[model samples]
Target: MSEAAKELNDIKRLMMLLLLKLGASPDEIALALQVDASLIRKTIPSRKVKKIVSEKG
Candidate 1:
């Protein structure tokens, strides 16, 4: 990826984590970002997803 593209991707990934931290589900995050849930799942590490989901409730 180009540096700019990588940076944008990083920002998107960070936003995903932030949304999750705020108790948004992956599906919700995807919807808010206009992306697919599979992309959200692919972007975030599984362990982090597990941690956030567990802590969300």
Candidate 2:
């Protein structure tokens, strides 16, 4: 993937992980991440979710 696309994907993944850890609803996370909730849900990993959330907090 192009560098810009890769960066965007990484940001999206991190946002999803953060949202999941924060216990933010999918819709809320999507809004915060400026993307669709389904996309975030699909991209984020369950294992890393908590880590991202905690780090953000």
Q: Which candidate is the best by lDDT?
A: 1
Alpha carbon lDDT of each predicted model: 0.76, 0.67
TM-score per candidate: 0.69, 0.52
lDDT of 2 by residue, 1-57 (tens): 899999997886666666677777677877875888777666664545553344443
| TM-score of candidate 1 versus the correct structure, residues matched by position | 0.69
Question: Model 2 reaches what TM-score against the true structure?
Answer: 0.52
Q: Which lDDT tens digits does candidate 1 get at residues 1-57?
A: 899999998898888887777667788888887989888887875456534445533
